[model samples]
Target: MRWRIPLCLLPAALLLGAADEPQLVPDVSQREVEIQYSFTGADLLLFGAIVYPDGRKPDKPADIVVVLKGPEQSIVMREKQKVAGIWVNADTARFRSAPSFYAMASSRPIDKIVDERTAAIYELGVDKLQLSPSSLNDSAELSRFQEGLVDLRNRNGLFVERPGTVEITDGVLYRARLPLSARVIVGDYTAETFLVQNGRVVAAAVRDITVRKSGFEQFMASAAENWPFAYGLVAMALAVGMGWAAGAIARRI
Candidate 1:
């Protein structure tokens, strides 16, 4: 994962702006997730408070949007077309950077909360994800590939979008739940909260969450990564031994 400033801590330049800027205090339910053998899925609760300078809750309603993004990786999307009555790979597009997992929850519909420009800048929705290709391609072709990738990811539960899901309490504290599929990639994840007001982002926060294999899963992962050949050999040997044991038991029976 690339280095990025934590959203909870505002930069000096942004903090110097003016009064009335909403201050955010954000936190996640868990800072780390461990993937075990029986791991099914996980639900992460992101909660935060919006603090004002005067220490008074606002009368006006404020919108909140939370985004959870996993590690970024280069992905090769292939388009299959029928060739001589057989489906074959026809076109391939290599995306320079794409999130392995993405899920969002917002207080209201994104379009209603922020304008298109702000949405695009923040990459609010999965469709608005910035997936630049490694090579130059036709505009129409690139769009098709991009759409296909998003659709594919969404279908696989890697990309998710939920609007009007964030719950606000007393116009200050807000919370949202983000789900992670069992197949979620293991890496560093980011949780971002945006306070939108009048079609613009007023305050933002970012936090890091780690997803990693643990216990037996962790040992296997380490072995495979550090000693691939030995791991493969051991796995093959285990399979052969299991097969032999089963065969012997059957013969005795």
Candidate 2:
């Protein structure tokens, strides 16, 4: 389902009015996402506006936190146990940076929009991700391996947290709806936007998305990543010429 809008518009920090400095005019409903092969998932919307800063629109009520991140791997997470009875894999935790897809939306519920040290400093939920771990365990074994790596990346949907899925209107538009399944995971993705008020973070924005893998699944993923030994010798000579043409059509049927 090809769709790629987003034709340049991110050089607007000219601060048209520049009052309290709040102006995140983001946008993204697909800006280069082509993962073919019956790829059945995608729904990003992340609209924006929030100009404010004296240019009107603001009588309180202002808090929109949307974050859609992906790309930044380095994980290990293991903790099984049971051992002799079956389980196994004792304790392990590598996580030096995780976020191969993480979504968070809010217009409320982020602790009433800010606090808890500004949502653990920008991590804004997913249990305040910012996963560390590279050694020094303890603290209940690093909170049981960071709650088993956020419960195995939230049951393999690559972690997601939607609190009040943002949706401002009168206060100067704003939207959200970032969903992208089918085990999404290609590369480069970021769409942060926070503006909160009283609790801080007056403004902030960032965008950039790419996803990838297009037609014919991107030509066999670029021939197994740029000709891996001629794509394993042409996939073993086409699996031995389709097993000798299916044994001569099963001996002429």
Candidate 3:
């Protein structure tokens, strides 16, 4: 006698045979974000599901790390020193590729979940960011400049790190929330998810997000970019008009 498996069980059998490593399916709350005149900020939800081989959760729960990174730009970092009772630029360090915005969320403190090497490789923490220095060769100088840049951006709410923020459920689903600063520049961004188990990154996935200007802000940005001379004239006229109006009001008062 010959027996055949049921159709529903066929899929399970196939998965059991084909599945070896875990996989990540990730998504972001918003694919496109518009920055208008009243734009304050936004909270982005990064969620995903983890698919393990044979549809079985590992005995040891895995960890999740989510990173939201904005476009890269070349930046010059200036160090100011008091000279003759006035602060002036003393040294400058240029970075070839530095992230305009970067925020990271992890299930636990990065040091608790992964070693320094692993953290550095994946940039799990803000301090692990790899800002490629253009010219500086001295290790100590480069480190100082990098720290200064990170500190400046942190004060501006551009670089952020939140530990113990990612929530994992049933060892299969995970979610994290990251904030977008109002000062973020318009560009393409990426939300990356990593599944870490046994101190190794098992699977990773990414979702794209776009931040753009809209309405009056969009029009102004376009005008400034496409018609620089006209925009400059308009800006000067507005400045002068505002100044005159303020002076007139002060005189009348």
Candidate 4:
């Protein structure tokens, strides 16, 4: 006797077998960004395509989230308090791994797309960032310092969150524009893209970006790094010369 798959179950099995995991094809507008004296800021465009299995578009649309992160740095945050009519440092918190710059953009508000746990896991928003505080063990104190650090960076345009800024076309193509502040440091950066469907991340991709100094800025940065003593001596000499020139001009006038 020959056994065969039931007609009703055959289609389901075929469909399941044919289905493949979705993939992301991501790219950035600029892979190398040069910072110069005239560098004010830049708009980084992250675009990607979602390749579905068998060219089948899902009935439900997927969400796109893009995160541009700079190199991590250790930071110390100090809380200031008014004591005897003067402001003084009160408490301090040190973070071991804090992103020097971080910006996030999403097709919709992150909270609406993913639950808190998922958001925290991926750090989809500024509030979800895991700034590892090295000094504070108290949750409340750590939270306060984290908030303060985020607020300071937000004011400086280093930490940014733009919900509903990502654009998706036909559930296949997605793009987002994130701002790079003038104060961004010269280092390696990463642009990460996440495709979310049914409150789950289905695919993810990453692109690298390099921010570096150019022209005289590059020369100075290299000099400062390679010859710190000479760089300092030159800087002090220039300061003294400028001061002397200014005084002489003033006397002449």
Candidate 5:
């Protein structure tokens, strides 16, 4: 009889313990790298608010400030017989500088997923060609390098200043802000993020985004969207115009 009571309790205990066991799924490949954006809109305005991680936007982004020498920047590529490969400006990090492409992205100190000490920059392609155009190399072989920097600039280099910064606490979780130049030429751009430790780079990620033009902005962006500091000035201008008109009517009265 005592054996029967213990046996009855054993079954209950087994059922209770089973609830804490981990799932023994056959495949684990379903969890892969993924990037998602919240708004499905095209044109990402220069000074507009950027929401990260679609479902979870942080209250404060641990970001970086990247200021570029827009007018002076150039992306060039060449094919050298010695290496027998196309050398892009130097190489393509996908998220860093490429011929005619400049881009930047930041991080949120949220999920313990990002390493903060590394340098992170954004990049995209502007123009590209094979080295068959420049007169510098008269040889037909030099023609390969012709599709170089000149062609990239001719496709329209952006005169932009993307100011951003990166910060992570305990070497994980991040947030950032990326601002494009109001004069940026619309195209497919790649945004990159990185993690570094003690001056050494460790991790890299690349994402593709489009800078489009549409909506009411096709005519002219409100002066505020065109320039960050100019927003205040635009408001002041409207105020001044109203004051002037009010004064003129009062004077006639």
Candidate 6:
């Protein structure tokens, strides 16, 4: 949501010895939306996708994991010359799954949001819908990646990965199945992109997320209902790749 840092002014007497003393402060940054979707009921799925306008392409057929980030907007400060500083403020309150604080009157309908519209509450689906970078790779060895992810999910009070996570290979799409508990909360849930090393989490990309059942779900329902096949292929391919990687990794061990 809106994160503010208070500034403490130095007493005039304290600065008497310093003729030209200057102080710097953390300025506000821009905000961005991570994901947008439609869902219903406490039992819902998150729909997300990343837009990569420009980047590198690898042919190694690497595994794909999504990590959403804070809202599209974040606070940014600019230092113009030596004596002047600029501050910019933004938020991700509009996105359904922003990392900012979320409040919908506490008792309002899930679709309705009454929190800071110009602020971030919690990060939305960490990067699934936000186009964040991949947090894991094969050569970067570590441990307890999956377990850590499970723990993170548990601590966040979530039952599974944000709905609608997709993987793209050679321009083909795939879907992912995330685990979730029945008692998961109905709010933002942070997620990560884990690098699995020997069946554990080694490296990870962290993302703040939000979860709710609202109009966004309804929007996706129409789209998903029309082209479930496209979604199916993406999900299947991701599964096969993960499975193959796991098996191959075991052989090496």
Candidates in descending lDDT order: 4, 3, 1, 2, 5, 6
- Worst 10-residue lDDT window for candidate 5 reads 23-32
Better of 2 and 4 by TM-score: 4
Model 1's C-alpha root-mean-square deviation from the true structure amounts to 6.9
Cα lDDT tens digits for candidate 5, 43-153: 222121222333343343333222221222233344433345653443311112332334443332211322332222222112211212323434543433433444443
State each model's C-alpha RMSD to the native.
Answer: 6.9, 16.1, 5.7, 5.4, 18.3, 26.9
Relative to the unseen true structure, what is the Cα RMSD of model 4? 5.4
Clash count of each predicted structure: 1, 0, 0, 0, 32, 62
User: Of models 2 and 3, which has the larger TM-score?
Assistant: 3
lDDT of 6 by residue, 1-253 (tens): 9965444545554556342322111111111122334212232222222222243332332233333222332222222233346444321112222222211111111112212321122222222122221333432221233333324444664323332244333532223334333333344454444322222222234444454444665455555678789767876899999999999999999
**How does each model score on TM-score?**
0.87, 0.35, 0.86, 0.89, 0.30, 0.22
Candidate 4 wrong stretches, greater than 4 Å: 1-19
Where does model 6 exceed 4 Å of error? 1-56, 66-167, 171-174, 177-182, 194-207, 211-253
Give the higher-TM-score candidate: 1 or 2.
Answer: 1
Ranking by TM-score: 4, 1, 3, 2, 5, 6
Please identify which of the two predictions, 2 or 4, would achieve the higher lDDT against the true structure: 4
TM-score head-to-head 4 vs 6, winner = 4
Best by lDDT: 4
lDDT of each: 0.91, 0.83, 0.93, 0.94, 0.37, 0.33
Tens-digit lDDT string for candidate 2 (128-219): 88877787457788887888788877887777888997888888888989787778879889888888888888888898989998888889
Candidate 5 deviant stretches above 4 angstroms: 1-164, 216-253
Worst 10 residues of 6 by lDDT: 102-111
**Model 4 TM-score on a 0 to 1 scale:** 0.89
Candidate 4 per-residue lDDT, tens place, 199-239, comes to 99988999999999999999998999999999999999999
